[model samples]
Target: MTRPAAPPFAASATDPIRSILMNTLIAPETDQRRPEFPTQQPRIEVVAPLAPGDEAILTPAALDFLAALHDRFAHTRHELLARRLQTRVDAANGRDPKFLPETEWIRLDPEWRVAGAAPGLEDRRVEITGPTDRKMAINALNSGARVWLADQEDATSPTWGNVIGGQRSLYDFLRGQLEYTSPEGKEYRVTAERTPTIVFRPRGWHLVEKHLRFHDRAGRSMSASGSLVDFGLYFFHNAEALIAQGSGPYFYLPKLESHLEARLWNDVFVFAQQELGLPQGTVRATVLIETIQAAFEMEEILFELREHCAGLNAGRWDYIFSIIKTFRSRGRRWVLPDRTQITMTVPFMRAYTELLVSTAHRRGAYAIGGMSAFIPDRRNPEVTERALEKVALDKRREAGDGFDGSWVAHPDLIATAKAEFDAVLGERPNQLDRLREDVEVGAADLLDIPSAGGEVSDAGVVDNIAIAIRYIESWLRGVGAAAIDHLMEDAATAEISRSQIWQWLDNNTVTAEGTRIDQTSIVASMAAAVAALPRFEGDRFDDAISVFREVALAPEFPTFLTVGAYARFF
Candidate 1:
């Protein structure tokens, strides 16, 4: 039986006007003019202190745009988040997700294809991912990468300053006005010759931007969705400028679990384009197939966003985290090994990437590969060499598998990644013509967790604890993309660390040395993890430890560590 059709934006049970507002705002006007705003503008309460330059980005008009976005879509976002919890609960209860029968037509229909590469995104052989701070922005734009993932999600700690400052950096960069000077008299500027196509990644639907509160008509107030806040502010401020530059406001949509979520994003794109008086398909988005559930619905997701879809990215780190989280309660078979052991070549991971490439190519979309997290340390030649070798190997594998491009966490690895793609792609912008047809992946192949074939280790547990603590400390200090032991660590990697600990403890996993991973053992390991780190003057180790323990040791697994951390601390 087909699932019942419902309005794209349903009214909240408590807020009847939500549906009316959504219809009025999202519905294309008769003459194609901008949608009329509600009579009483939704009150936007700024809770965080605005820095001196924030006013340029958060103008009255921009805030009004943000408020309208919130008022129209916040209710639907809430529903989707609640649906996520219920789906996870169902998965925990053994209702494992399969390819949707209702959407079988979407998968089987072979003629449908996503909107092919936008102008600047034609040759994305090496995309660099980083936070949008001034120095990093300058370095990334100069990194010789084909694309720069201006990340506001995993790579950015959601401090108010970081949020608004990130927008300012992107705004100035587009206008050729972004530059920085160091205390030691060093200069950094964006050289237009080497600048990459900018693809912005807003936060996922699960997070809230506490700095901005949206007050409804009846004086009801709630935090705005971080996804809308990030997307709205950037689109409102820079859409026209990007268009004038012959590129659109492209995006990397992250952590989507189902095609319905993709549909919502497609609608948002449509509404944003209509509101901004641009063409319907002007904005393009690449969906990250990072969750296990999303793997099942890849074709459907592409179909959902066909008009505005750019392609699909293999978000390898978070994909592993999603597998662990979805099946955490399903017993020992679901337990994962060390984060380092879960490479893209593992059986399930290989299945995921292979399927991603095949599915994307079949749908006429770009099949981007996963990130190489090995950031080179310039001081240590040996470490840098190892990183280069590791990155080359990974990128070579992806290119061989017919991937159009891949991601690198650091500028140093960009050449290593691009060289592999260049060896395969040659003068061609992409290998989209090399459709990978022999790939056949089933649900069982994707769920073959035991195929990973590595043992849980004492050292692995210690590393998980230590890395989680270290990364959390960095996050608390307003640093998101942190280099720990020569590898770039972000929220996705940290999620794997803490979630693995919880899975191990919950399942009574015994290490290879026969030590049962229980609460007592975890406490002992926590001390070792803490002691191993060097002390700094303004470290938030105490709070970091508390946050790690709370999420990792909770009876019920937290959907995302960042959600609670953002709520309680920031």
Candidate 2:
């Protein structure tokens, strides 16, 4: 197939290869030039258009390093992913997750501790997360929060442009050359002293970067693992620079299910460090204990990566989605209430968070709280005040309960969340010292879904359908995080919304209004929601509806809506 012409902006750039790469649209193509490598020469074909300035990040050295990573770890990743499937099936079949008897000794051993926090990460009281686009990257780095999660996972749509463009943004940010100019003549740049620490979040193990392919033994092209592609590119390009700037290559691992998965990541870290001639433990990672299975193995996860571990994070939305997913086939007892009703204070959620804090502290690691999804509405003081108040309450709970820090989706909420943490921290950096030995939880506590009491409502169902469609539409447009109804909705939130609809319909869940949720009600609600939405040019409302319905009403629930929806775009 003939490649599309590069965008005008992309062509005007100084770099020749960048112009060529950016001019070529992403599609499956055969590799014409075979390059030599130190050990192996895996065939790599890049189909994505290299956006303007992307050449600086996608250098030959970087691509070679990425290929080396794939050569070494791709096979292990495939095995671990297969293990995840078998484990999920076992969980759904009534084999509840608990602390592995084999790994109990690691938890009991009190002398072991995770490597101390790297520089720029010692005081992460308030961290803001967003996609790694130019404007958002500049804004987030300038935000007063202590850390900025440069997310390439849930907060990113994984479009060809996004995958390459995001790397360019991060590359520029690390080099202190990232800047953006608004149409209104406002210029944004990272302030040296005030810039938040950068911590990258790569895509999860389950995802595959279809635009980049590696040849297998049979000479058939296979999609490269998303995790390796993202992490490899960033680390290969910027690890040395970050280390020189008084910080190491920091990362946040997402959607990990077991300590064994964590072990795979640790092995990758070790290999990457050795490959680049960096010292051992130069990379620091914080694991998001999002999956229900992971919650049961926090200590073991930390233990596996102790030399490279920084902390643990309370991943809220995905955690709820995991609960629904693992127990989808198991009847009503496993069914959760409305997504809105499943707050952190619920018995099961509280148990999860408490356990997380205790586990992190016990292992001498930071325990970061969940994201406060409330985006500030500046037009209405009442709305802003209410949102801030709720945020304050949530932060206060986290701080009081021995959390080291927390996350906020918006820069506006930083002060509010910081103040709450400040009140409890009071000049101290973190609460890792306050080990909550008092908290004891069992499998029942973690699985106590029936205790989160609230009935499904028609409004709740409509909200889910509307948000899922809206978010997916934005995702199709290459925007991962969307501010809708005064809340920031990302892939995680969309997953929870759609998965809840699936679970509800499958269980014949009745709303408080004495109505049973079925395909007919869902169809009506979907139509009504789409109609109520204001029309926009080139909006993918229809596509979003189709994707949502397929995932929510399919005979077998898809692992992730993005897995199926991604094909529509590429």
**What C-alpha lDDT do the candidate models reach, one value each?**
0.87, 0.86
Candidate 1 regions exceeding 4 Å error are: 1-42
What is candidate 1's CA lDDT for residue 478?
95
Model 1 quality (TM-score): 0.94
Candidate 1 clashing pairs, residues 3+ apart or interchain: none
Question: Residue 227, candidate 2: how far off, in angstroms?
Answer: 0.5
Per-model TM values vs. the true structure: 0.94, 0.92
Per-residue lDDT of candidate 2, residues 1-570 (tens digit): 232332221212444443343233222223423235534543666767776677787777777777767666665566556567667777778898887776667777888899959999999999999999889998898788899999999999999888888988888877777888999999988875778888999999989898888764334557888999999998988899998988879999999998878988998999899889999999999999999999999998898899999999999999999999999889999888888899999999999999999989998999999997788899988889988999999999999999999999988899999999999999999988899999999888999989999889988988998899999999998999999988999999999999999999999888999878888877787778888775699998888889998989887899899998886665
For candidate 2, report its TM-score.
0.92
